[model samples]
Target chain A: MSAATEAPLLELDGLVTEFRTGGAWHAALRGVSFALARNETLALVGESGCGKSVTALSIMGLLPPANSRIAAGRIRFAGRDLVGLSEEAMRKLRGNEISMIFQEPMTSLNPVLTVGFQVAESLRYHRGMEGQAARRAALELLDQVKIPAAAQRFDDYPHQFSGGMRQRVMIAMALACRPKLLLADEPTTALDVTIQAQVLALLAELKSAYGMAMIFITHNLGVVASIADRVAVMYAGAIVETAAVDELFARPTHPYTEALLRTIPRVDEDSAGLAAIPGQVPPLSAMPPGCRFAPRCALREAECEATDPALAPLPAAADHRVRCRVRAPATAAPRHA
Target chain B: MPEPMLEVAGLRKFFEVKRGFPRATTVTVRALDGISFTVGAGQSFGLVGESGCGKSTAGRAVLRLIEPDEGRVAFKGEDVLAAGKERLRALRRKMQIVFQDPYASLNPRRMIGKALTEPMRVHGVGAPGERVARAELLLAEVGLPKNAMTRYPHEFSGGQRQRIGIARALTLEPELIVADEPVSALDVSIQSQILLLLQGLQERRRLSFIFISHDLGVVRYFCQSMAVMYLGRIVETGPIPAIFKEPLHPYTKMLRDASPVPDPTRKVAMLRIEGEVPSAVNPPAGCHFHTRCPHAMEICRKAYPEWTPLGDGRGVACHLHKV
Candidate 1:
């Protein structure tokens, strides 16, 4: 649990993003921060509207320039500050050094264009390959993603492929440039369970083979357990806890993390009953005065309502951090540790 | 032994798809090809499958919401498929259904009270004066606030709206409720709450449920018995705990194994079975799953496997248990 001296492949420090709605600016991401090492997968998990996708979009520079702004923060990728990077610079880095795959590939992809052409476009633009050279690379990319009859299907349009195959094409495009970091936002959620397993396994294999670090965003905890090296639990626009996949599941420090774990019905074994969190996520526009999760948290006390809690590292395990005053006491170290 | 509240036999529903647009040849897509299972008086039966596996179709077909080409659906030993319009309409009140999407199921513009009372008004269950009081009572029964009746569907969260849907189902006092992926759309916390509410309602009302879902965990917890469908056929049907402990069919085993267990350290044996489901229009000649089964043999491709019973209502359709 000691601090890692080595530099991470990507890091975000005190990132705050706001959106202008109805002429009023509202903060959607409040002081969100995390880091990912090369070849390591950090699963960003949260409920709907928890800013999981927004964080990914913020990093991709896909957020609306007119309404949303990164008010304060540092986004350092490979030791380079990327907060205020010019659009042209970001374009050069995006898809070449970093690529993103969304939840529904069918919608994300251009329907008219052949998937092969779409996948090859990244190669031609990023690596400057031409004609046959690009086509060959695209076919190889398709093969790597395990698309059956890759060569034969190259000329087929997006509609010709199925949901699972379309996702593979999306992955082929994302990995075309061999990006150092891949931001996958619920990439497997739309597929069937068996197909989801296939995609997750493919992603795991691809990550290792290419030595690509990834920020895998998903709402399913079971997906996080197998696919992630570590996990960052986000709630109400900020991370409530960050721990190794095993530790977070084993001993969740934050009340929200604990409740989230208890809510999942078990397939591996019998569960007495699911313990649901009492209330809904507070509306973002009219948030509570103190801890964002205080209203729903069973462990919430008077002091928790009076002051907002900041994410703090537990002394016994420097890597395990929790943003909870009542549930995680600073003085008392983790009992198991 | 107590007679099951609902019974289905050799149910089939097929849709015709036109391939190659201009010179299109119509092909039969066998959505629900002769699948059958039962639910006890107050026990839940889960129907689990992927997108095109026909679980939803089966639910709709059993309820007579969708007319099936062939099948025998018996509720309380009465023929459902052969029932006349008046009889079928009367039977509908006894067998209701809850849809998956809470938002889409409810009328957004109408108040929740009116939405709940409309069924009773059509069935002529109660006096006009009693419908309003009944709506409020049903709302509270599903654990929603009394004021929920006056609010529109948009005002409620996904979880609350689901509760409203459940309440609407209860308004008819149906003996069996077909809940199609009822909790799949909500957050995990909200999903549990709905599951618990259903569990409590089942205990209190002695209501049987046809629980349909892609999520094995939720189904395993909610349904006492289950049927795993593959390519429109029930590959396996048995008690949920028994199936979970030891899956007999390769397809069911693959589904169980593929389900992501929340435990990080539990590494399930990775089966080599691959490929998405083939089009149902022209399903593999014999066993529909033979194309993707890890232990598929030559005989599997040559002939369709017969349903083999393993006693205690546990059965499977596969060549592996041909003895």
Candidate 2:
């Protein structure tokens, strides 16, 4: 096997990304870590301002230098540590070996450039393929993403395409280089529900056909269950739990995950009433010590109030695991086939 | 149901768009074209559609925030359009509105206490201390802390700000409140909390609410009756259970399928709404949803379908459902 195949496609080890704001260092990601295998789809699921997108940006080296910094961590992709990589080196690595598709296409893509040029510019720069060759590749990628009239509409600008079509162009641009890893950050939030399903299905098909490792970041558990192979629940910049999709949905170990899951409206449910999470997410600057979710968690214990929980394997925990001080001794087993 | 709390018939509002430097030819954005619905006393009615479907316009029309070119809004057996300025202002005290953007709706320069009390002051209800006590009670009803009265809008989070907006609306103690996309801007977990609060307040106060939103799931959970709007027209009007379980109109079905349910294993059959919603400035003839409707017949393209009742109180304007 090749070295890239032997090693994980992307491996993060104890990644700590901090921001220096108001003259005090605030750690957004506290020793958060995970590994992405080739052709695997891992979902980073959490509520708003939960550091999921920040984690994605850290991987892409796109964080603003003024406020944020990677205090300490190892971001290894295909056996290369990206922590200390030069700007030029990182720029070269981006959009070629690795690519990212942000949340909103209308904002992400340049309004001044043609859709074709936006996609082909990366091909021309990364692969040094110029003129007709790059243009041809761009059209082919658009067609692959199921954009209609790709040859004719490649000249259209970002505003000309509808929300769903613009997102397709974004996907086409991200897949131009056939990158080994694709980081999608809330790719379907701006689109309407029907359009969201189409984009998600397109991503699933494209991931399988290209065998690309995808880090799908979102707050919607429904999206995760439909597409994710494994799920990681994050809170206050920490991976509170990780498990197979079915296992996590059937039985969430962390109190935060359980509360988050219960708060969502279910398809099978017929109740006219909503089950609400009582409190809002705590601000990062004034987060309480110990369990970050203690204020909102229903089953919070005294132990949860005194000590910070670390990711650990419960006595009967499956490959599934939880990061909490007072987890039940018995692992939450799969309840569904 | 005792003449209903509010009844709208043939409501239409067309905005004349000015174009070019000279502003020669005018284009009209048919924001609301002959839409109708009724909100029963102490009942919560939902108006749902995608962004530009005129759901907000319908809510505003009911409150007379915007004057309609044609149609009538009968509020408690009296016509709102025919009411004089003094009468309208007097009627306004009975019908209030809670806007969608809490941050923008409330004056940023004003304190929460002043914002809440100002409405009651204008209506000339009670003295200062009584108003203050009432405002504090309303704030507590919406779940904001008592100390929140002294703070500014910027100091509060989205959910808290929304509660302040609710408190301000409750200051009037109106029988009907027009809530326009009240919780869409907040996060999902926080959205549920606001919904529960609204539901609780609606019950405890026996307030009638016309809830306008693009989110079908939230509407299904919160509203007993719902009207599905499309391009400034009501395509489906029925009870929530009937509409969700057996949606008669194509657009209604598409909307139902579009909502993201929490169940991961539920493979929702793919039913997409074709093309972007047609601009309200130049809507096609016949059915408003005909351009994108999958079940559109030949007659639907050329002629508008009349409101057809489907045995029960449920009514739909689709040709396929007509009998």
Candidate 3:
């Protein structure tokens, strides 16, 4: 889809985010880097406390200002640097050019306000559409997201709608401004499996329909396979593996990614036992000195425990990359600018 | 089959809810409607369904945690519902439950050792000193450190807390454990650890489990037989691998197809059914799933489908399956 030659819609070069905890700053995201092509769906896959959510928050400029800070790195979005952007400028850009939908739709939505008003409010604030025009647009967006009887349910408050329907309302509001980018963090995790499929399908359709690049953050690899064009597997606050969706599934290079794939019980096949990752994720405050994953990695060598690995492209496929000292060592030079 | 560990028949639990602002009319919420299943000795029977489909209610009702409206729950041929208070209390020793949220189920202020041993203390299983030793042994069996006994529930991670919950359930040496979504709250990596631990315990202890969960993959992995519930009714019930391979009921088929497989080769099927699950209070007239069933007919909408036995312990309730 002409994404190859086009400039990346968003790029993060060595992004580091830290939070002040117990009088000390601990990095949650350690030098994370990725480039999102226009209209591409990049799935950020990781377990909790692995900094996937933090990456999304960093991009949205929504991190808690009191304790969290973007210690280092540049977040360039649509030809503009967002790391140091003022709140006023970011606010205008947020709903207009970038929007996000959270996991719990009920919490994200205002219970007091009607769903229609919430959707219309974004249009009014961002696009200057008012009154009847805004209402009509909001209803149309809801219909687009396949909210059944959208017009009739327009005046209903968030509490009136079911879990799946509330998620649809959230999507409609996020899409109201017709943003260029959408950051969705576990948008369907709370819904039932059937409803999750519905929401995922809706997201895929809308992503293509709007031609918007999306950063879908989720711990579910199944969801990644369904929606992602590319995937970045994060582990202990670092991108351990990155590849096209098919390639990542076919040949997961990073030990963490491989272990994770094996750990999940598959619906399609039967296995004797799930291969559990040996230990829990290291807490941010007590992160390993060298390779973050080395402590739990099966193939960890002595060298891995001494120095962290660089994220380098694989020799077989240039697009596929992994941050592992043993698996995909930095023998080959960096190819990307 | 060794008289089966547990047999539930016509289990029903209903709650009356008052709705509306000014005039609240009492409506019966049929959380569990005449659902039944049997868990054989050392067998794991999965009650699979979405939220509000009564899987959780059935689990609780079987244990008499929620009194059933109309049902016979026989634990090793002993009538659980008809048992006396003293008899029921004794029966509870052999049938423990593991809740979905371990954190919520556990007393945060209580020490992990105390939580583990308190049940034995209540049941008068052993001396106070012996209970403490049993608690330590249980912790070791669940792969937690003996020292973990001294820590509070809040100190441990979600996975560790779940292990503690498992240990507490085993204090009475229960034959049947009603594990309700035990791993659903944990991360995928941690989920596998818990699953493996549960499997190990089931194998070692010969524990019969009423594993209630919405995850088809997990249910398929752990359960030998399963009952797929929809709107408080069993739409399909059969042996796993087989039922999952060729699901007879439309609702079961939809659920299987909707479950996202890890492999990207098989694209998630376009949802065959539309609209969220109808509220239990106002479930559709005849067959509860008729409204959303892809192959629903006039007959399905007119009368609830009878459970047609397909032999070999397999059955389905659907108009299309009628002879």
By TM-score, the best candidate is 3
Give per-model TM-scores: 0.97, 0.93, 0.99
TM-score of 2: 0.93
lDDT of 1 at B122: 97
CA lDDT, every prediction? 0.90, 0.85, 0.91
Instruction: Indicate the residue-level lDDT of A223 in model 1.
Output: 88
Identify the runs in model 1 with alpha carbons over 4 angstroms from their true place: A1-3, A331-337, B268-271
> What is the alpha-carbon lDDT of model 1 when measured against the actual structure?
0.90
TM-score of 1: 0.97
Tell me the deviation in Å of residue B79 in model 3: 0.3
- What's the true lDDT of residue B192 in model 3? 92
Best by lDDT: 3
Fraction of native Cα contacts kept in each candidate? 0.61, 0.42, 0.65
Candidate 2 residue-wise lDDT at A239: 87
Give the range where candidate 1 chain B is weakest over 10 consecutive residues by summed lDDT: B266-275
> Which residue pairs clash within candidate 3?
none
